[model samples]
Target: MKTAPARPEAAPAPAPPVRRARARRLLMCRPTTFEVSYAINPWMDPAVPVDAALATAQWERLYRLYLALGHQVELIEALPGLPDMVYAANGATVVDGKVLGARFRNAERAAEGAAYLDWFRAHGFTEIHDPLHINEGEGDLLTCDSFILAGWGFRTAPEAHREVEAVFGRPVIPLELVDPRFYHLDTALAVLDGDEIMYHPEAFEPRSRALLRRLFPDALLADRADAEAFGLNAMSDGLNVVLPRAAEGLARQLAERGFNPIGVDLSELLKGGGNVKCCTLELRAPALGQ
Candidate 1:
């Protein structure tokens, strides 16, 4: 019998370069007419109504606004007994084709993380992970094409910031959120069309403010009054912005810049402490991938 020729060794396969997932669509949970922990705790505000009818109406308006902006909205059923669950945006972060479930800093908001994980699994997203360190989802993350700016202090810790950097393999700038009122990074800042950022100066440290200005020299400084009215941190889809109905002046500014502003009345939601950007969680966006 002829001896068998030796098999040629197999070439090693090259490892695939990691790619960050881009958020093109999003998920938003409308606030129900329930008492949010913040609104009830410490001291209740009698003026803020938590009746089901009013909350439902406000959420419907918010839904219409998101739909008008060309977003594929996924509405979640109200979680009975969990008021903060309405702020679903604070639940998770999508990066590098993986969903990182949050570990909320606020005890009242902790249940939101588990809800996010459940949603991820149901949507067929198998690459889900969570940081061992305390962090509160996309609220702490502000991602651009090159870097992710994470806020630490109230919602996310310094240790969580470092862990996020390791997971993304990119630069993570740690920002100290000095103001407790504006708990998350998104509450104080947002990136709009053309790399322009809308931010509130009073919410950031002087050094952090300077760094932001340097990053986007052309960034328009939104007025304090407008910022307070939810004009500064509005969500944009390159063509339009979902803003507060009362922000007509800011809308005019955006219109001049070629953006169509669609206003939504989130009065009740705002009273509970947030607006459109705070209510909606962007799962992926185009700018995230360079």
Candidate 2:
């Protein structure tokens, strides 16, 4: 009998694309114990100086807001009396078992990277990387389960976006910010639940606006007055939101819609050029199969 023919070997299956795990634990800096500045803009002269009394009160309010939202807030030790280094949330984004520390384009804030690196290592985040030539941070990025939208212009550089794409092994949708007044993406755009987004049209170019509309067709265009008043593009947890106390009406509306709004009075912090989302960093969620 003839020997049986050798069976054809099956080709190895292609590797599955990596999926970012859902964020569960977040890192937020405590303003009560930290020295921060709010003299971010003089041209606009729009922000109020944060005295000790005002800063204390605002910290209390922000702390309460975070607690009410049910997040396990880890207050990192204040950075060695660095008054201007307290804006921690603008430093990084954690996803898919990796930490992408920010490369701040602003020379005034370049020290932010070192501060964040210490925090990341202290928290046991080993997989970390950043762009060599450009500065980028969470302020320029909006990450979902599927993709990351990177805003490039005043705050985040084009080279930084490319670095993010390379590290995450995913596409980084580039958006050009037209208005310098907005400063960062978080100042003018926010991705709410589902495909709904909240934005200020004036902050973006016509091309960027068109792209945003296409990406989030159901986006809610908030009045510029409301957006500006409340820091509408600030950070959110999907289930809850932290906003300026002045946004009482918006908070109520969100509450009625099944979202828990934790309103914090960040007038002092905003004076320094940031709000709730600007002062904390969310670490990566535990990877699947962990």
Candidate 3:
């Protein structure tokens, strides 16, 4: 039988273009009350004087930059005695209009943690799941596309991973952070988008490192200098990545991967042991169907 002329081999379907801005709505707290008054993490030293005004100015610059990029930047009122409240990402891990409230391990930030849960409640997040385990909110719970990458063994509890998985209806991969400098997942890892991540290998345990490698074969490894500069504490709008001004190596690597790295000076905030991502928490409204 004469073979029907081979149909022109069907062209492989084009891969969907990577998008930025999937995590555009952000919740930020002003360094209006930011101060390194007490030591919590290794980055903080009570003896080192903090410039609150400069911190405010730098925070404003970062906030305005986010606004200029057309992202929703919401704010939380600063309360007295909560110096670390400026690290908004530690407040809560919000997804699908549900909040996994943070149960802070540190007594200093405990109240600030309560305030975050209340904020979620007042703002119409009805399904707030109280933590049975200590979790410093988005500080350890990094939301990727269909799953949440959770880090424990330092700041957060591994049990929080199971809670996150149940509450968010997403898989939660628990990675153990071994380095004191990278106490929180945000400090050692930056989720670029759904399919890719950039992280510091030495900060994680050997098993966690291997898990990261397997889970994210396309992961970008942050250089030691960049990691030490808190470079992994970066934020992405899908296209533009807002990061520390000192992380030039990371910025270049991001550029190579087709991401626009907008470096901003968060040195003042760094005194508090956080940077751009630390100061910002992404808000995914229920309407987004996250």
Candidate 4:
């Protein structure tokens, strides 16, 4: 009888794609004057006492963490009267080295717009647009790879979307937010990597939800628990994600997706209706020779 053929060898499994962390240039403010004196959003309740010291300590941790992660941290001096100025992401939206200065919807934050724009002007940013429409900077406008995803029906006016598209020369996809609790787009959604995002669907209108699904088919979905914990209010450098420690469920989901999730305690800052992404603003300067 003929000898049996040798068995075929098994092929080794392919290695997982390595995720990289981009070195970001971020802007942040010290929460030295943090307090919830007024109720602008549902999260803010002046009746509840705010721990200013704890908020400062927590903010410092986040600031130091950015430095430790090889990201450039820039500070815009915090104005005494403007308690919410600590949410630096609302100052401006920087893309390709161009600045779109914010126009606050509330009179309480009106002066902050001028302060931030002055900083950019003083720092040598020329291509700046002082928007005519009411917009909240990165709080309502988020940049993706080829387009800018904007949220309206809350803080940012729908007209602001058109102005941003013209200023950036990029396509703007408008998403309508319905929930009062998730007023700002940054509060309800966080961009993970290039064109990758994680969001709380219930925070948006039905049409906006459908649009999000169509745009980002593989986006991470966060439950109401995680959303309420300010989980979606996160900052990511592609591979590493910094979010609230209270968002245990989102952390697990991020870890399962091969992302390094860094948990931080910003509960004190939360009293003022802000967190990681709120405190940190990304400065997306163009690459040399662009």
Candidate 5:
């Protein structure tokens, strides 16, 4: 009788890739005068009472968290009349030391663009473009690895996408937003790392959804509950992800991908139709020696 051949040992499961958190220079504003006085988007309701104190408290925590995470936090003095200035991400879009100033669609936020541009000028940013077309800054224009993902059918005009491409010297892919609730692209989608993105499909038009699928096949799909919770309005420093605390489902998905998701209670700020990413403006590659 011949001895049976021994079976080969099974290979061990591969370890997940370790995520690295890169320090970022972020700009934010204190929500000292935050209010829902005007209905700019679906989230804002004048009938609903806003706790200005609570909004300030929540924003402070987020600001401190950024500092604790080894990120540089810069403050822009909030103007008295502009209640929506707290959404600093709407002020401007900075990339590779180039600044493309925002041009708001609604008159309510018109002055915010100049206010942010002033800060950049004071800080020694020379390559700044005051856009001719209407754009909502980082609110509708998000940077991927080598290109920019622009949003339209809401606040930002399609023409602004071309302006951004010309200003940043990168290809811009425009995605049309269909749902009123997800007015800003930042509200419906988030850039996790490099070209990795997560978004809610229903927020985008059918054609835009198809485009997103083609571009990022492995993108995380958020459920309605998470999307409504403003889960997709998240900020990532390559590894650590800061998002709304209500987005528990999305947090778990991020953890599975080897990310550290820091959930924060920005419910007070949500009343103003903004959250984590809305309050954060990343100043990418500021002019050296300035």
Candidate 6:
């Protein structure tokens, strides 16, 4: 009888939007000796002077910001002669504590790669995969929600993708980059969440661009302007995103989605062809039951 009033059917609860868990633990290197002594990518111009003190100060601000956000910031000691070492994302990629060492393509950065691998080994990444093929670490390899996205036709070799799949025990989707500007995958695309991606199509080949659309049907399309400012090279911690000061469009877009965008001036490091994501590496830990 108490149930006789059969409470009006409760409204069905709205389904939660699918999202990739935000990264909290990250790896970063101090720009103790960063400078643009040589040009590796298009964005790097040796003629353009870089202020080492300014770069160090900017990087300090970023590191402090990550800490202020309650993120675990790991470090690899800053060594002399490794001017580009500040772009820690390029050193190596960590997937569930499994380290995939970088086999850098250029000799100038070769030592930097080895230094990173050494640090990983000394720091408890036991399952280190010394690369058999040249791969530029997280700059080209990114762990999207259920799978890994590999970028080639630039720094990382296609062969490396297969090795990554075998090592990580996950499906690896290879996307080819066509433009030199977006030399690294991190420079062209940012995984906003599990199902949402932000990218600039001009950086990718038509096939890869089409594949991105098919894979992420609701991807956010970005323009060359955004790419120029390295908008896609942003680091997200679920609720907040750290991006370049010049990426106003990306900041607004993220703000509309309820994300707090923290912009920083990484222009000094940009002389070596990198930005926010470039300085940060998300080191994922092992999943439960591992």
> Which residue pairs collide, candidate 2?
38-271, 38-272, 89-279, 89-280, 103-135
Better of 1 and 2 by TM-score: 1
Show model 6 residue runs off by greater than 4 Å.
Answer: 1-23
Which residue runs does candidate 5 get wrong by more than 4 Å? 1-14, 286-290
Tens-digit per-residue lDDT, 1-290, candidate 6: 35565668889865545333354888899988787788879988888878888888989999999989889999988789888889999998888778888988888898988899898888877898888999999999878787788999989999999899988898998999999989999999987666567888889889998888899887777778878999899888767778888988878877766667789988888888999999998888988889
lDDT of each: 0.71, 0.66, 0.88, 0.92, 0.94, 0.86
**Model 2 C-alpha lDDT versus the unseen true structure:** 0.66
Q: How does model 4 score by TM-score?
A: 0.94
- Runs in model 4 lying further than 4 Å from the true structure: 1-16
lDDT of 5: 0.94
- Cα lDDT for residue 178, candidate 5: 95
Q: Per-residue lDDT tens digits of candidate 1, residues 173-258?
A: 77777877667887777766535566777778888888877886766566767766767547776666778888778788766666
Q: RMSD to native for every prediction?
A: 16.1, 13.3, 5.9, 3.2, 2.5, 6.0
Q: After superposition, how far is residue 231 of candidate 5 from its true place, in Å?
A: 0.5
Error of 4 at 193 (Å): 0.4
Evaluate residue 48 in candidate 5 and report its C-alpha lDDT on the 0 to 100 scale. 95
Q: Candidate 1: where is the Cα deviation over 4 Å?
A: 1-23, 37-47, 285-290
Candidate 2 total steric clashes: 5
Q: CA shift at 209, candidate 5, in angstroms? A: 0.8
lDDT tens digits by residue: candidate 4, 31-91: 8777999988888899999988888988999999999999999999998899999999999
TM-score of every model?
0.82, 0.81, 0.91, 0.94, 0.94, 0.91
Clashes of 4: 0
Pull out the clashing pairs in model 5: none
For 193-273, candidate 2 gives per-residue lDDT tens digits of 544457777888889889888877756565666567645645567666667767666666556555666666777666666
